[model samples]
Target chain A: MSMLPRRVEFHEEGPREGFQMEKGTYPLDDRLALIDALAASGLRQVQCASFVSPRAVPQMADSPELFARLRKRPGTRYTGLWLNESGFERARACDNIDIDGKVVFYVTEPFSQRNNNCSVAENRERQLAWIDRYIALGIPFEQAYVVTAFGCNLGGPVPVSAVTDVVRWLVDACADRRIRFPAFYLADTMGWANPEEIKRRIGAVRELVPQARIGLHLHDTRGVGGANVYAAMQMGVDLFDSSVAGLGGCPFAGHKHGGAAGNICTEDMAFMCEEMGVDTGLDLEQLVEAARLAERIIGRPLNGRLMRSGTLAAMRC
Target chain B: MSMLPRRVEFHEEGPREGFQMEKGTYPLDDRLALIDALAASGLRQVQCASFVSPRAVPQMADSPELFARLRKRPGTRYTGLWLNESGFERARACDNIDIDGKVVFYVTEPFSQRNNNCSVAENRERQLAWIDRYIALGIPFEQAYVVTAFGCNLGGPVPVSAVTDVVRWLVDACADRRIRFPAFYLADTMGWANPEEIKRRIGAVRELVPQARIGLHLHDTRGVGGANVYAAMQMGVDLFDSSVAGLGGCPFAGHKHGGAAGNICTEDMAFMCEEMGVDTGLDLEQLVEAARLAERIIGRPLNGRLMRSGTLAAMRC
Candidate 1:
């Protein structure tokens, strides 16, 4: 079997997922600057912000305001995170966002209770309701990110069946709403995935819903983020969620030992794909500069290595 | 092609290369303690120390004394670094070392001049002289590490022919000395190798000398260390040189942007192999603890991720 794919695409989450975990709230100007930097770096999809309750996620309290102020860059796709009707309406109110329906549903009880303050079954019902509401509003669903699809911190050992069960249910819900071309993401919320586990889970999801577009939202908590991506690519996966400077992991994402800091570094992932002869269509040198800008904004070094030591291609160039 | 090997082996260099770049000299007791910890951690090949001059590498100044004090463990092989005949003589004087010859030669002019303070030709001549001295002493020559086999920081690009030339010269020299079964290592000294470079060089070496055993000494500076290892394994390489807690970078290894910290983390390498269903014959948990101890001794966090985020096997165990 081929060890890699010919091409890959990434959704930049630095402004949304990356900023969510920071201790201090970045000024709206800095957030817009990061989004602009990502746009200039050739990232097609940028998850700009989450319209979550400001009280729960104080870091993103100004999501709507930031979205209002962000100068939409041409040729760039912008989206926002939404978990409920209120969040969806907030995202819809913004002119900057090009995509509206972004939903996160927990696959396990412990994670649902811990992060959402609800049980898994309740979260599933709420997700269905939101899907119907989104369809009623004529908004095409972007992606239904299945949070903690691999495993959870409090609810450990999430079986493959549990994950596929959620996917199958989501498919049924989408059909009920007459929504076609559904896309789902397997989010390793805690970064608790190995290559075998990634292959097994992705295989199970494919077997159950072959028609659904699948993507991975991986965390580098265990440092296997790249390996897991390679494994997924070998199984024909190409779409992924990453953050520049590898920024952000919800404070809750911290393990008993160390924080699974940030999503897989965007530049690192792009560099890996580029090195494997996979076309990423990203300006990696610019991405590295963006990561540096992020570090300057955060006033501390982030967890990305590529920003520090550049790509071989860039070095040779 | 299969993405991995069935069995992979690692030569631990935390005690040697890891310490060489540290700012303060670790007291002899601390050094001995780390070695003992490594010995107990089930590493088969532990690179103990370098016999370089104290004036140059004060961290390794007490190599002979430390070697004399080590309680050698059975089932574990010990080795030391030797850049020339004088360093080889010092290693020869030690009773702890199992493999008799260890040599590092540069394949690029920039690295040879910058690192060794000599031209590539001069370094090659000295390597041959050292090999003759080793053969005269009846010491079996082990691995001839081809530094900058992939690319160099100062030297923009190292052609595959440069790598194959050095490997071919080392093979012919061994034959002329009546030495058999020579081993060669493709060292990405500046971490300048990508997956393609690794494949091209290793493929070239295999075509030129199919009988020669090949290994990789990779650096994770570019975050592709694991990817490079996977790429090499797909081409049939199973032996690697790594440092515990991913330590070392030859104070010269740091770039203007970031310090290129050490080799691939030993536990990360083992974890990747183990996750892919390959047997590393290592006690990964013990190795992680050894890394922790190294961190404690260094009084700072090391570059390893597995130590911070426990491995899947260890977590399950």
Candidate 2:
């Protein structure tokens, strides 16, 4: 009756996601220190920065320098986020940053325009062009992200058909190019997912592409991120993208208040997975230390709970 | 395969739980305002105060005055917490406070001594005396709370047997007195529950007393509180005790940091339930306003998400 996975993979996104949304400008050394701490905590992949316009996201303007100065850990992949071809080129220019060909499509048009300044159809065409370039550059296709897969803040209550349509499009595009279909990541960009909605969406996507591995990019914007993760795991989803200390919020999400939560906390999710007898391969103590360091660097309290409560392992000790 | 209840009941404990854990002394009017706001938000039961030793919880020393000046909302039951006969007497003396006899036992000995200042065995004896008093006073017995039902910070992981033992004791005690067995509320006094553990423990308790209703009093100390609530709902748990704006942390739980979270946020949980199509008989906008009011009174941002992110219903409109 239990559909839980035996192991779960987490991609840490605190540095890129957390800092970009923050109003204050942090020192480049502080950013690198946070990423280094995350990598040292045994996170296999740490999203170090976002390669976007400096005028738009002033906090992430030092993406290239951050990767250049990062103390890379063995067995860890340093990654970055890029929305357009130019941003992708910026990431590819950095030798230390991991470059894998990835495509993204928005589930809703309003979000697509606001987040990427392009229509959904236009974004699809852009992804096709990127696919051709990836094939030519010998870069392995990593995954396609379906942003706002659950529901959009600008456009409410996304239909499951909309999500499946994007997945179907990705499948057809890969097939047309004679390339294998990569994994798919369903992103709840605005924290609009409930547990049942998570299950329904995952089931729908799985029904369409049974062979593709599905990952979740959830936000705790409305306090159900952990439940959404649990729901996905019950459907055997093993991949997650989380932020350390629950650090990042999307500045474009149109939240009225300053306290909009970021992605589900990395150490909190890892703690949940490990406590349920699932192997996360991350040290709780190290992650706790990283979370605390992140809080100290930010000079404010972050939304993470494990950093404050201490791990149950410590209590057992 | 979905076992979620069609309608869920929530008992708001913000005024008692949130304010007691808060360090600053709030005005009595502010406390009454919060309770009134919670009741107006369509919460059926609001726990306004705790009748404990003033020396122990100075914040709640004005419980009697709080009840006296409370603007009673029709069809809403204003309740208060009491752990002993003296506390019970104080609550009984308040004409406006809804008095229902409740019993509590600790799953772990260490938590029992620290939280209630008595051993588990001594607490059981005290509960027996309280039961006799309830019978003598012709008061209706409401429920029995199994504190630290999941795990204890001081005593480590609690066995499922430890939980069932308390449930069995409660059932037997009611049977001995020829009274109907009351509902059992499992309190995660320390935030140690995971989703799998929630299912396993709820299943174990149900097997022992199939007819008795079960409620959960959870803390979001280390996150996963929402997931635990969802897991319990999958087993058809309809009753929950929550704090508004996620206010309140146990002063005795030994959290090193000041940012320890309280009970799961009432508005956030209600938002989750409503979004999932479960009727919670509460207005989301009203609850959100109440949560904001709580934040203002606490003079800090509370750990709720919906108050910041707004609601899907508003977006759809």
Candidate 3:
């Protein structure tokens, strides 16, 4: 058997997942520019924004407005995560020339309580209620994502049994023949995963949610993001969630505003995939340009070494 | 098979290897204090200093004097390394209680010429001559060390035959005399070794010199020091050379000093060994004290994160 992965797919996380927690006030024009650059790189899907309470996440205040302005590519799917009825309504009211009739919803219990001032039970009820709204609107459920399947900040180590129960909720949401099964995604909000961990939990996810398309959204805290991705990929995970110039972080992770501290740089991810004989479709040069643009917009170095040092090894003289 | 190594040992590398290449002048008293601090940590063996030409390694100019001043501790065999007859003679002249009949002659070849400013042939002639002198002075030859048996900077990937040839020269010097054969220590002078490289070369060494006690002295130039030590330890290597605070770097390698720059922290090695279940007989608290002392002497924090963070895991709760 080959040690290398056989195939690869890419996702651009810059617009929504990358800057959702960023304290720096980014203009919508700059956000659009970053998205345009990333979309130009040929990434198929993006975790665009969260339709959550603006008072809770002011950084995502203009989430709907920003999505309204994007000149999205034909094949690219923009996924906006929602938690409650109000946020889903706000996402549904957004004006877009070209858009799909699917909506993604996630229930981050420990985080929803902290960030949304609701109990875990309330958050779960609200998310299930939103799925009912999705069925009422006749939107397809195959495009929706149930994120943070791994664990949460306040609740540590999401047991595979817990995830198994959560997938049951998704399966029920698609019952009654109104919607297809919701797509699944695992989000490591606190970025604490080793390769063995990925193997254990992701292997469980594969067993439980075998038919659902899964994407892994990882944080690079503790220097294990890329290795975790490599592990997941080895276990047959095809889709990945990453930010250009290594964006995104938790507001409360203490010491350096999250960003997984040393996050998995997308350019580095591209390099890792290519080196391991996997194709990411996104060109390296384009990704580098996207990183440079994001860095200028974010007003800091992305803290990725491969971008600083050229990707290819220097030829021996 | 275990995903982690079946067995692993970490070599404390900060004091001996780190202090030797540093540019700042350290007083002999300070050097003694540093060595004492390192020894207090209970590290099995440290590669004290090379007794080569003072002009070539001016940093170790007072090695003989330092040997004289060492506060001898019982069961702690004070070891000294020599590169030639002149060095061994100088070391032998010292009548200190610390190293009366226990000084080990260390002469490495190939890259040894660049380090000692003498050809391999000249080094062999001198080493053979000094072995006789050591016998005459009644110093034990068991403490003697032949370094760089793996590969060299000046001469790449040293053939196994070259190390065997050097051992044969040692055999000829013995003249059928009965004494313990000198330990062979492989050195990564320029740090080009990978795990595979170490595994292959170590196999070759054990194949030829099965009876010779083998040790590894590695520098972390390419971030493989920990991996290499882990590999060697798994292969049954017990003896390794380390410095307190990870203070040294090969001047022949890249620049950028300080704890974060190059050398692997001695505490990291200590931590690795302990976690991997290998008993290195090291005192963690004492090593931390010693590491901080080494850092103060160098006017910089040495590369030991464990010292600052404390070796034990702190409770998040």
DockQ (model 3, Cα): 0.10
Q: Can you rank all candidates by lDDT, best first? A: 2, 1, 3
C-alpha RMSD for every candidate: 2.8, 1.6, 7.7
For model 1, report DockQ: 0.44
TM-scores for chain A, candidates in order?
Answer: 0.93, 0.96, 0.83
| TM-score evaluated only on chain B, model 1 | 0.93
lDDT of each: 0.80, 0.88, 0.61
Tens-digit per-residue lDDT, A1-317, candidate 1: 25566889998988888788877888889889989999998898999998899998999888888888889878788888876668877888887787656667787776788777888898878777777776777877767888888777667667888888887787787676667746778998776777768888888989888877789998877667776787788778989999998887544444554555678889988988886679988998889989988888887657788888876765576
The DockQ values of the predictions, listed in order, are: 0.44, 0.73, 0.10
User: Which residue pairs does candidate 2 place in steric collision?
Assistant: B248-B262
Model 1 lDDT at residue A72 = 80
Number of the top-ranking candidate, with lDDT as the measure: 2
Badly placed stretches (over 4 Å) of model 1 are: A1-3, A117-119, A175-178, A207-212, A250-258, A313-317, B1-3, B117-122, B209-211, B250-254, B313-317
Highest-scoring model, DockQ: 2
lDDT of 3 by residue, B45-150 (tens): 5556667777867888887778777886554545565655577677667644233232222234445566556777776666665566667778666534445444
lDDT of 3 by residue, A251-294 (tens): 34454212234345677677666645678887776777777788
**Which model scores highest in TM-score?**
2
Give the range where candidate 1 chain A is weakest over 10 consecutive residues by summed lDDT.
Answer: A249-258
